[model samples]
Target chain A: MLNELKNLISKEILLEWRQKYSFGGILLYVVSTVFVCFLSFKKIVDVPTWNALFWIIILFASVSAVAKSFIQESRGRLLYYYTIASPQSIILSKIIYNSFLVCFLSVLSLGVYSVMIGNPVQNLSMFFLTIILGSLGLSSVLTLVSAIASKAANNLTLMSVLSFPVIIPLLIILIKLSKNSIDGIGWSVNYRYFISLFSLDMIVIILAFLLFPYLWRD
Target chain B: MKHWWKFVAVLFVLYAIIAGFLMDVPALPILHETIRNLYFHVTMWMAMMVLMTISLIYSIRHLSGFKNEHDIVASEAANTGLLFGFMGLVTGMIWARFTWGTWWVADPKLNGAAITILIYLAYVVLRNSIDEEQKRAKVSAVYNIFSYIMLLVFLLVLPRMTDSLHPGNGGNPAFSTYDLDNNMRMVFYPAVIGWTLLGVWMMTLKIRIKKIKLKKGL
Candidate 1:
């Protein structure tokens, strides 16, 4: 079962790479969004606000990618083929793939954002920890929502509608943590946000694992 | 045609209006005039939950292939649910503008309710987009079940992690603590029951109308 799942995940990753547009489009969207934010905020966007903006941009970019994760499979019996393997495996593979994608995109955005905004990173370790925790929460959530939304007809709009509310708590925590990190607030002061975010990630991922097989079944 | 149901509904509306005027009758201090909006906002949320619950129950039945009535019940309940959801949003917005001195804040309670409504909205959109009736019913039933779980996670579970000005947050007692005294309970409990019954009543009428239309090939 593990081997089959690994193969399935690898296949999905390779397929995504072959398509190219999915990754390229998401990267382009992230870069353009950052540019737009820079244009609008200009010099007025402070460090903390810029940090919040960075997370928001990453959040939307992650959402865009995950929302389209299953679109390519919608055309054929690709979903059926996967169901023949195992629905749980399929969900796991998608979650893993999307999580990797979101993490990568988040890092890329963070790098570009730092350069563009010229905001000083006070604590590299804490900032990286925040990104890791925050992206995990986001990827788990987007994976679950995308699994459900992909089965819907209007996948994009439905993804937004279903995901936005569910993700607000995580978004709030991420924004706070990012802001605190940018402001050089000690982790002791903002540890609650990290705990909340990690707990949310665990709870949501477990729920998704339990619930996703049902969705995959006819 | 039972006259009592409509009469009761109208009476409740009238009582709500009367209560609105008497909201500042010097007896109630904590809630004050904002309590007037409570009659509408809380009632709308109760109605929305009732309708969504009905939708969920019927979705389960539909998925299990109990009967076609389940689909009609789900659809009608969703329609009624949306009505209450919209009212909840509007009323809550008004309440916030008055109480919080702003039209909106990302308060957990308000945001959770908004997200719940959006999930249902997506459900309706999902149903409308699919042309095949059976497929639509089955897929939506699955989505409905998933959404209810998400709703619980969003509204009940997530709020505990953060500070919210809304009731039931950060050591602050929920409305049930002091706000829902016996005097308020008299009207509040009845309001919940009455609004729920009316929601179901509207749903039943809608389902019957749909059945009739189908029978007449309209």
Candidate 2:
């Protein structure tokens, strides 16, 4: 199972590599969106507003990058996976792949956002920790959601409709957490948020693992 | 005989409605009379939660057995849950308007409630977007489980980490925290059971209607 998961994760990475346009497209997406934010706000003077805008950009970027990638996995590809892999392996690999994918994309987005908009984040390490947690939570839920949506009409709108509500809660916490980081608040004020965020991620990952087998079957 | 709970539900609900208005003693400032809403407004949320939990349980059963009957029941329960959620939202808004002087506020619990509504609305939309029978059932059940857990994270886990305007959340006086006394509990507990049973009754009725339609080739 470990080997199968490793191979599946590598297969995803290889596919993303071979189709560099998709990878480059997500990068361009991040840069362009940050540019748009920069254009509108000129320069956000308020730290909380800046924090909120940054996470919002990351949210949209992840939605576009991760979910679209899952949607494009193709019926034939899923069928091929269905033949060779256990459902647990498939979902685990997809989640692992998307987590790293979105994690990288969001980090890049953060860089672009801070460059264009001015970085006010006071605690760099704590903020990075939140980003890592944020991406994992976002990708795990979106991967399961896209898998469910893919089995349906394949309507792209359905993906947004399904994912946004589920994602909003995570976003609220992430914004609060990062806001704390931007304010340079000490970690004592943050352990609760950290615990909640970590537990939330665990809950989502566990749900995806347990429920994917049912979804993968005919 | 087996349907005794329906009679009990009706009896309790009728009593709650009548007494909820006529028998309130607390006279707190701002929320003096409106405290009576605890029986009506808050119970809607309780019922919604109970109904959604039932829906989640049935979704798991559907996934395990691949039974169309269980899927139908799951959807119906979720439908009823959504109805209760709407009731809760409107009542909450009304309650908020009178007390908070606004139709909405940026609070964690309110945001959580809004997210809960959206998750189930997405669930309903997901069910509609799929065309195949077995595929829809299987796919929706997986989604039902996944979204429910995420919603739980928002509703249960995240809110505890933040200060909120809602009672039982922060230090705000809870409709007379000192006097959530037996007087209130007498009505509140039965009201909760009454509304939840009423939601279940509605769900079961819809399930039977669906089964009949299926039998009739509709």
True contacts kept of each: 0.45, 0.93
Compute DockQ for each candidate against the true complex.
Answer: 0.40, 0.80
> Model 2 Cα displacement at B155 (Å)?
1.4
> What is the CAPRI rating of model 1's predicted complex?
acceptable
* Model 2 share of native interface contacts: 0.93
Q: TM-score of chain A for candidate 2?
A: 0.96
Clashing pairs in 2: none
The 10-residue segment of model 2 chain A with minimum total lDDT is A66-75
Quote the lDDT for B193 in model 2. 91
Stretches of candidate 1 exceeding 4 Å from the true structure: A39-45, A74-84, A147-154, A187-191, B1-34, B64-67, B94-106, B165-182
Q: What is the C-alpha lDDT profile of model 2 across B57-84, one tens digit per residue?
A: 9999997888889999899999999999
Write the residue-wise lDDT of candidate 1 on A1-218 in tens digits.
Answer: 79878988898888888989877988999989988877787753467667767877888898888877665465456645654687777777777778888888988887777677666668777888888877777887788777667666667877787777667767877777777777788978878777877887787777777666656654
In order of appearance, the predictions have TM-scores of: 0.83, 0.95
lDDT by residue for model 2 (A1-218), tens: 99999998998889988999988988998899889888888999998788877777777777787776557877788778878999998888988888898889878977887788888888999999999998899999888888888787855888889999888778888998999998899999999899988988898889889888877768
